[model samples]
Target: MSVIDDAIVWLNDPLNWTNPDGIISRTGEHLWISAAAVALGCAVAWPLGVWMGHVGRGGAAVVTVTNLSRAVPTVALLTIFPLTAIGFGPKAIILALSLFAIPPLLANAYLGVREVDPEVRDAGRGMGLSAWQLLRKVELPLAVPYLANGFRIAAVQVVATATLAAFVNGGGLGMIISRGFGLGLASGGGQVLAGGMLVALLCLTIEGVLALIEKALLPKSLRRVKHRPPASVADALPAGS
Candidate 1:
């Protein structure tokens, strides 16, 4: 049978879905780690990004740090994590994945705030709005799109990469993948394929759900601006043309 056929067979086998080491159980563990990483990334990056963007001092430093984090390899971080106090568990996996998630969230939030119109900001200040008020009332709403985008990017990345959890004895779909590999290429190929497909499907589902939430939560005016149709050919043409 073809690889796809084999994977389907492996997936359809009822026995694979119920045991302690089953798909349902592993997926739950994977999502937990991924969510935890995203939560930590948001906590660490979002405030700094917003503050720097608002203050407009030290933004360069923040960008530099974000870039540095991106340069660090995921595997290297996971490998080194074992030597530190955070050794070989879900905590270690979460730490590594959180590092993976930070750069995009920070950069997007800062850029979003920076991109807000100066005139709007000036008007807020002229109206006697305090710095905090200006941020909350003016900038935060404008920055919501970028903030949501950062979440989308970070969450998807975390979900995909959380496969690393299995390597350190952290449970996730990756454990199934590891087990498949242990069984050898010919015998285990179907299991590996199934595990990978599950991760990919989960990431896609997460992206779709987040996209829907973003659309629903966006300010109505902003939503209109985003979804407004382009001018028709007749409308764009010269008068009577």
Candidate 2:
């Protein structure tokens, strides 16, 4: 049968849809776990990133640590989690993906804050703005685009990496793929491919929605065209001087 036909069959399969045992329940559970991990990662990373960027201190250290955390193989890390201690299910995968998420979130937060123009900051300070006031009124508004971008990236990563949960026997769409692969569907792994495709589509949809949100959140001024200064003499002439 064609791939589409195979996918339809797989989708209609009663065995695939029903939450028999806790295994079937894992799909929803894993998605929840991944979301929680992303949320937790954002909570920790965003503030630290914003602070580092605003203060212009410890950014390199933060980046280094985040990078190092990202570099750790997630599967290996998941494996290292003591099954005896934590058992299986969502905890191990959440820990794994949370670490995976931190680098991008932190990096983006730092980049967002750092990207704010010094002139704007100086103007805020000159207007008698306190540090917190400056952050709230000036830096944060400017940094939001980059921050949102970071969130988008982190969100996609979380969705994709969520599949790794299956290795630990934690559920999600990965369970579908895993089971399909093991069963070797009549269409030659088409079921697994279909399951994987569903995940890809979900990620794409999430990214598109987030991009729209980022666009909405950013100011029109920031969204406007950024033109380079004209060359030399003509550009230097004052408008009315």
Candidate 3:
């Protein structure tokens, strides 16, 4: 049979999914590791990015971080962690993936806050809104879409990359591919193909779900509406007259 045909057969086999080391179990591991990593990345990136963008500084810092993240291959980190205090296992994978997740999150958050209409900021300031009040009431609401998009990008990247956990005995879907390779090409090609297909499918599923959520929360009309400061601010404003 062709590799595709063999992969279909393997995927359909109830036994492959029911065993101790099965698709379901591996997928669970993949999601857990990916979630932990993405959460860690968000925790570190969001506040720093938002602050930098809020104050109109740190553009160079964001670029440097983006470049550094892109320059360092995740797989290299996975291998190197084993030699450090981190040693092996899921923690190492999570740390590496967190680094991988940072650049997009940081870039999007900074850009989002910066993209807020300057007119809106002026309107708020004219009303005597404090910096904290402006950020809380005006900038953050407008930037929600960008923040959501960043999360989607980071999450998708994490889910796809989590497959590498197999390399560190982290027990993710990548283990299936590695095991297949261990069996040699002629014997294991189907398994390798099947594992790859599963990872692709999982990534697509996550992306679609997050996109739908972002759209629902920040619908088109709502996204376009500008934030208006309190009546006190508006009343105090000098008329065009």
Candidate 4:
């Protein structure tokens, strides 16, 4: 039978979906792990990023870490963490995934606050607003869209990365893929494909939720505005010059 046909058969088999270790349980595990990783990442990154941007300091430090984190491969970290005392299971995976999540969250929050109009900052100051009040009322509200976008990036990344959990004997749809790998091309390739599809679907679902949240909380103008492209060299030159 075709791999696609095999997958359909596998999917249709009620026995394959028994509660404790089935797709349903695996997806639940995936969601919680991804959620924990993202929550921890945002908690660490968002406040520091916002505070630094508001103060107009730490941009260099923040970007340096963001770049460094991006450069570090996820596989390397996943492998290394298990060797430490954290030693396998969800904690190790969660820690690795959370680090993977931090760069976007931190960078976006920082940029969002920094990008707020100087005139707005001045207006807030003019209103006898304290530093805390300015950040709370003016900067944060304006920065919300960027923050949400950062959240979207972080959450999607964590969900996708959590599939690697099965490598460390944690849990997720990767189990089915790993089993398929053992069964070879003829019999179980469909299992691998199905596993991958589940992960992709999870990622899409996360992105959809984030999109809805962004739409509900932010106006269209503010969505993803932090990532404007640079002007071309011609556009950079003064018109008269």
Candidate 5:
């Protein structure tokens, strides 16, 4: 049988879906670790990005740090963490994944606040709004879409990358793939294919859910409306006074 056919058979088997090492349990483990890493990345990067953008300071620093993070390979981090105090455990995996998630979160957050219209800031100040009030009310509202996009991107990336957890025996969907490979391809090819498909499906699901959330969080005016035919020129004109 073909790999796809075998994968289907493997997936349909009740035994594969039960037990402590089942797909369901592994999926939950995958989500938990991904969530922890993304949350940690947010907690570390978001506020700093917002503050730096608001104050218009450290633009260079933000760029440098973001670039540095992006330049480092996540696999390299995974390999290096075992020698550190973090040890070869879930903490090491989570920390490595969180580091991988930080770049987009930081860059988008900075750009979001920085890109807020200057006129809006001036208008707020003219109304006796303090700097904090202006940022809270004016900048953050305008920046919501950017923030949401960053979060969505980070989340999808983390979900996909969390498969690396199995490399350290951290237990996630990756473990399924690794276990399959351990058993040799001739007998385990079906398991490998099934695990890959599951991870891809999970990533797509995360992206779709987060995209909907991002759309919902947008202002009503900013929400995408269906395209319509142009109105006739007469209809475009105001009624006779």
Candidate 6:
């Protein structure tokens, strides 16, 4: 049979679709685990990022640590975790993905805050704004765009790295690829290729959705700043004159 025909057969097979020990079910669980991990990572990273940016301290340390974490291979980390822990599953995958997410979030947030114009900050001070008020009203508003961009990046990374979770016997599209590889070894290579293709398609779809969200969430004023005219000489004259 042709490779396409074999893939079609495997995809349509009832065994693959069944939730229990089925490819589809396992993949869904994997996605959920990755999503949860990304959520948790964001929770931990965002506040720390904001605080670091506000204080203008520990930015370098945080970035260095996160970069180091991301540099560690996910598969190697997953493999090592099982040695420490009895089972390999969602927890391992979550830890791995969370480690992967920190650098981008922290770096972007720091850069975002740092990029806020000094003149604007000076203006806020001149207007009798406190440090906290300046940060909230001036800095954060300017930084929001960069913060959102960081989140968009993190989301994509989580989705892509999620497939690796399958290697640890964790669920997701990785399960399909793993199963396909096993079947290929036992029989032929058709199923492996098909499963890998499906995962790629899923990643592409996720990326497109995130891109749309980033565009929608970005501030319109940041994209196009409207300039107000200076006060007129007529208006400057006394009201009773």
| Cα error of candidate 4 at position 21, Å | 1.5
Tens digits of per-residue lDDT, candidate 6, 138-241, equal 88888777677677677778878888877877778777778778666445466776677778887788778876786687767764212211111122245553
Q: Give the poorly placed runs of model 3, Cα more than 4 Å off.
A: 222-241
Q: Which ranges of candidate 1 are over 4 A from the true structure?
A: 223-241
**Which 10 consecutive residues of model 3 have the lowest summed lDDT?**
227-236
Q: Assess the local accuracy of residue 70 in candidate 2 as a C-alpha lDDT between 0 and 100.
A: 52
**Top lDDT prediction, candidate number:** 3
TM-score, every prediction: 0.88, 0.81, 0.89, 0.89, 0.88, 0.82
lDDT of 3 by residue, 80-112 (tens): 887789877778889889988888888778878
What's the distance in Å from true for residue 3, model 5? 1.6
Per-residue lDDT over 2-75 for candidate 2, one digit per residue giving the tens place of the 0 to 100 score: 87778777667777667562234655665688789999899998999899998898765764675476568877
User: CA lDDT, every prediction?
Assistant: 0.80, 0.73, 0.84, 0.82, 0.82, 0.72
TM-score of 5: 0.88
lDDT of 1 by residue, 1-241 (tens): 8777778999999889888889998888989989999999999989988887898766557556665775787877877886799866777888889988887788767866886899999999999999999999999888877787778878988898888767766788888888888888698899889988987888899889988898888876654235322111122235543
TM-score ranking, best first: 3, 4, 5, 1, 6, 2
Candidate 6 deviates by what RMSD?
Answer: 11.8
User: Which residue runs does candidate 5 get wrong by more than 4 Å?
Assistant: 222-241
Point out the worst 10-residue segment of candidate 5 by lDDT.
Answer: 225-234
Ten-residue stretch with the least lDDT total in model 2: 225-234
Can you rank all candidates by lDDT, best first?
A: 3, 5, 4, 1, 2, 6
User: What TM-score, to 2 decimals, does candidate 2 have?
Assistant: 0.81
> Which of the two, 3 or 6, has more lDDT?
3
Which residue pairs come into collision in candidate 1?
none
